[model samples]
Target: MALPEVSDPQVLAFAAELAKNDGLVESEVLATLEEASVQQSILDAIARPAESKAWKDYRPIFISDRRIDDGVVFYGQHRELIDRIAGEFGVPAEIIVAIIGVETNYGRNIGRYRVLDALYTLAFHYPPRSPYFRGELRQLFLLGNDRLAYPIDQLKGSYAGAMGLGQFMPTSIATWARDYDGDGRIDLWNSYPDIVASIANYFVEHGWERDAPVTVRAVRDATARPVERTTLEPLLSVQQLEAWGYAPTAPVDAERAATLLTLEGPETEDWIIFRNFYVISRYNRSPLYSMAVWQLSQAIARGAAGDRP
Candidate 1:
């Protein structure tokens, strides 16, 4: 039989198929199908081509007015949670707070996408990573049916299906999310403890070095050899950086690898990253992002340590 061209039956069938694939047949899946009335415009919008530009779009979103102010308040409200989680995770509180600040404005702006809708939209319609989204959909289904949350009513997030305080993708939440609040549920959506611990956990899992520096402020000469951005991995030795006229303010006694980072600041700014700095990149994969976290971490630490930030 030919599949229906209309949205209703087609979406219902897709949801049923997805549920069957995940062993959630009968009642659970049929209920999902009952709600599967697709809006062609939303689907069309999803199918529309995405901009090839990355640095331009993603950067501006981070620097937006709402994000920065929300980040500040998030840091203030979660002061104790940040300190405790940081100590436990061996990452500094500022980095932890900065991550929450960056990802979801400390839970104030987690997202609005329904897990079912967003995952289904991306899993089957969005071709850029349909397979990945399909897997995430599976995870979301399992997460939902298992009462792993407060039902679908409270589970909303980003268009790509990331959810909760950290804006974690379903797979990331399934694997790395924790019930730090001791409430038995890993509630990243509303629990400050869970969010705080989850961010720190993500950093540690990605190899943050305890008590080691995340980045080193640096200076480079105008005559320095131009760096290939693709080769931004932290591999050049500090001595090599020195030869290129880069210096780290954090003080390393030689024999350490670093990456040269040029950032667009209110004024031009540069930083040389140590191994730990590279670890921060694993969280967001941007030098500017990592630097922001590091700087914010410094601010939080100073404030907590009784110094004015």
Candidate 2:
């Protein structure tokens, strides 16, 4: 039923039935849903910044020389963990570290949102993606039951309701997370090993390629037009890209296998993307986010090179 239709006795009855099916206490579920307050926050977040502005605001938060350097040094510090995860899941250490650096700055800022509040607000009241949040809410409840951790008082992440070290959605925690440290708990909230392992698992499950490059910068010309941003699957070759006047900065082993991406930069700037670029986007859907990860990863990679005095 729709929001208004949720008042229907039939809808209430169905919710009641669902509660029973999910092994939830019916009264408790009703109380929780009734007291749930997601509308205000959803409205606030929606009515606030535009995506571009949000990107701009978030831009300065990432993509700094210092951050890049930190990433590089951090990668070295965790080289063993990264290597282990890479060997286990086939995800590169640089990308995984980049992801961790991007999501929480190496477990620095997880979030302040209440998991229940965020999920509930978006689930029942945020109409655009209510069904998705609703599913996440269900997942949250199931995750809470795993006995390793409970969602009730857990601190969640930003406006969209992602959680903990990796900023994983509740469903992602249940589905893709792992207990990598042999502690018998998938503690993405704090454990570095679990966080690293889970992130690697996410990339692997999503098809990260160890042999692939993340992205490349293209020299833009006045005649440049829109490059096709296709599905994540590989399609174009490096030679084909050169034909389009965009080439990889480094030598690519594959003759012609990459995706093209165009991004807006400071002062009418732009960039060309590659298959590895799409992999970063898999973690965060935004192109700006992927760029940040790539830039930060590059920074981190440099720091790991022992350039620091």
Candidate 3:
């Protein structure tokens, strides 16, 4: 296919800046950007992310019988490696698998849209987050310079440009991805060890505490009014939530910070999510996603114990 003209002044300016900053050949940089086209479907997908769905609908998509079963099998096959990685990183093995499961279904589906097209379309056309996408576009060029495992135009990822098994963005791939196999390269596509270490490293870097509690069954008093659900980070301490008559079913430190989450449904389930839960949310910044990861981790554990149907 012939390259399309990137006539947008912002895009042309960015291309020139990237060429200057990265020491990339200007013509090649423009040629690559010209090869990228605005994908309307990518725009459509971005408009309604999985995070926009209700917990009832979103839960079924990731916590299905097949996914839970696959997670059980995945954990079994990678037990030695996962365990070692977990021990080394101080993150739970189930959490690691659950993160991978929630992200890509054990690397079975890592999206299909060309990463370059996705980033270009978003960086120039998506107004709400154009600045963020612009940075990712720069990171993409940096990653492609002898760092990307595959050909630059050949890498496929989510519509928003998250790549590989853990759905890492270009910046994450550059800053945190490791050569876990010691093969002189970091390839997230087929390198399980690299993927494992990368995911664990991401969590560790973002403050995943060793053996820390993630979430707990929350009980609320009638005095408690539903707080805002938009907060993904831990904004309230356990002590504060306790004073508000929302306490965890399990005992935890009063000093530990936590967040309140209500799974929107007919009945409306509530949870007292801890700091670790907030750390998981750092991966995607959605309470629904973090909750699903925690729930799926429990389900996989149940299946491993022959308790899941």
Candidate 4:
């Protein structure tokens, strides 16, 4: 195919920077960028992310019976691999499976957008987060063939440029993707060991506490004061929240640092979320996404156990 028209100064500057800082060929970088077409559909997709939906709407998208059942079957098939990685990384195996299930439906539909086009469109066209996507584009170029088994131009992933079964962004893959099968290169697409371990490694890197509770339903008393959540970090202690009249329905250490989240579910739902819940947010930065993953993980575990009969 003919090279795409490349007149954008930002794209030109990016090519130059890659050539100077990363020692890549400027002409080759330019050619690669030129080959990437700006995808309006990708721009549209990013504009309406699933995270924009309400909790009640978002939960069913990922937490369906089919997804839970598929996760159970996937776990059974990869039990040895998942368990070994989970033990090694101190992250629950069901959480790992749930992440994959939510991201790509057990690797069945990772994404359709060509990674090059997706990143290019976002980096150049999407103004709100252009800098971030530009940085990802830079990382994509930096991920040499050695680090990524696939050819850069041919790779396919989500509109956000997250690749693989786990839907990892370019920066995340660079930082946490592993060669678990002990092959010379990291392959998140076809390698089961690498995909599972990389996700577990990401959770461990983000401070997932072993055997710690993710979240619990909370009850707000009649006199409870509304607490605005300004951040996802577990800022208030459980005791402090209780003093404010929001208490966990289940027992937990009074002194443990936690955060209160109120979601619009079938009925308004309140949750006292712990540090592990914040770690999950590190993966997607959306409370709805984190909650779906956590709930899906629980459902998957239960389904897997019940499938034994």
Candidate 5:
């Protein structure tokens, strides 16, 4: 089928900028832009991300018996690299693996849409985040530099244009990704060392504190104030929340900054999330995504209730 042409002025302006700033052949940029098609399913999926789901619904989706099992196996197989990456970056290996597990199921599902299509479709057609996706589309072109192992047109990723095992947005790949294996290329898709180190690097760059808590169960009381769950930052300190009758399930520093979060789904759950939790959210900007990574990492580290660690 003939793909519909994209003639949106803003989108065409994007292509012109790509050619002018990035040194792409003008005709080539226009051709590729024209070749890209609008994917309605991608648009729909982008509207309802798993991160918006209830904790109960979102938890099982990323943290499953099989996923944890796979995480353990992944840890074993990449033990040395995982350890080195963690030690070098001061981020936990389990947390590193958990991000990969949650993002792409340990590379089992690294997305299916052509990244070019995903970005272009969203950049021009999706009105709400057009400017953002247009920026991503520009980064997508930038990612085609030496970072990508394949041609940009051939690269596949999530509907949101996140690529590789880590599900890096194009800007992320451009700025934070690395050639950990020293292979002269940053291939987030198939390089384990590159993927591991790149993900750890992202956390370190985003201020992940080592040997600190990600979250603690909040002891809710009648005095507990209503928390804006959508807010990702920890504005309250451990002592402050306790004063409000929301104590941690475990002891915490009185001065440690945390934010109260409540979960609704299979059961009522609340917690005081720390900065590390906030760092994880920077990758996806969703409280549920960070919580899932935190919980799944704990489960992976300890193993299932009946399974061995």
Candidate 6:
């Protein structure tokens, strides 16, 4: 077969960077890029992320009876491993299950796109995030055969190149992925121990607080004024928010630093989110995503405890 044309300056520069950083031949990197197929659907998917939806709409997608029930089952099936990893990592097992449940429905539908094609399409065609995707593409090459259980060309994942049950990106796999099975290989796809432990480790690395509250519904007083939120980090104190007329419906330490979130539910919903909530946001950086994971974890916990059907 004739080699695909590779004259794009960005692609050439990326190949050079990969070769320089990893000591791989530039021609080989260019050959790999040339073989990658650019899918327009990947570009389209990136533009319309589910996080764009309102809380009312987004909640139904991941918080349905089916999802909650399945999460309970998944948690039950992996209870031993989950509990062990949770205790070792100081992260809750329910939160770990919820992360997998939200990311890939407990590995049923991890993704459809070939990771190479997805990263290549976004790296070369999507100008808005080209630099980021390009960096991922570089990391994909760096991951090599040892770290990845599957060959690079054969790996499949989300449109943004997030792999396995947790939908972890290249950087996450490099930094937070664990070999819990002790097989000296990190397979996020088939190994439940690796998957569960990797997720828990990620939470721990991002400062997950053991036994701390993630978020709580706030009863907004009629006289409350909207507080401006510039960042997701928990910056304001619970006392400060209470003074501003947003009191947690549930009890929390008054001195705890928190941030207020206003979500568009049936009616506008206010939440006093804590440091643990911020840790969940580190996984996806969307309040809606973090909230969905939190709510799903709660529902799953309830179901597992025989509180819900």
Pick by TM-score: which candidate is best? 6
- For residues 168-197, could you state the per-residue lDDT of candidate 1 as single tens digits? 877777777878878778787778888778
- How many steric overlaps are in each model, in order? 1, 9, 0, 0, 0, 0
Model 3 C-alpha lDDT per residue in residues 1-309, reported as the tens digit of each score:
333476778977887788778886666778888788899999999998888988889899999899999999999999999999999999888888998899999988899999999999999999999999999988988777467678778899999999999999999988888889988767889888999999999999998989888988788888986576567677888888878788788888988888788777667787888778989988988888898999999998899889986
Using TM-score as the yardstick, the better of models 2 and 4 is 4
Name the Cα RMSD for model 6: 1.7
Candidate 4: what lDDT? Answer: 0.91
Superposed by TM-score, candidate 5 places the C-alpha of residue 100 at a distance from the truth, in angstroms, of: 0.9
Model 3 residue 172 CA deviation (Å) reads 0.7
lDDT of 5 by residue, 23-57 (tens): 97666677777778899999999898777777878
Question: Candidate 2's residue-wise lDDT over 1-309, tens digit each?
Answer: 223324535326535765778876655555555555544755688566333554556667787776777777677777887888878887767778888787888777776677778887777667788788778877776665453444454545766778767788877878788888888767777677888898888887776777666666656545654567656545877666666766566666547577666554454434545666776677767777877777777667666776544
**How accurate locally is residue 3 in candidate 1, as Cα lDDT from 0 to 100?**
33
User: How good is model 2 by TM-score?
Assistant: 0.83
**Per-model CA lDDT versus the true structure:** 0.68, 0.69, 0.87, 0.91, 0.85, 0.91
- Which residue pairs in candidate 5 have backbone atoms (N, alpha carbon, C) closer than 3 angstroms, thus clashing? none
Write model 6 residue lDDT over 39-67, tens digit each, in one string.
99998899999999989999999999999
Could you tell me which 10 consecutive residues in candidate 4 have the lowest summed lDDT? 1-10
lDDT of 4 at 14: 90
Cα-based RMSD of the predictions, in order? Answer: 4.5, 4.2, 2.4, 2.1, 3.1, 1.7
Which stretches of model 4 miss by more than 4 angstroms?
1-5, 307-309
Clashing residue pairs in candidate 3 (N, C-alpha, C atoms within 3 angstroms): none
What TM-scores do the predictions have? 0.79, 0.83, 0.93, 0.96, 0.92, 0.97
Task: Please give the lDDT score for candidate 1.
Answer: 0.68
Q: Which window of ten consecutive residues has the lowest lDDT sum in model 2?
A: 1-10
Candidate number with the higher TM-score (2 or 6):
6
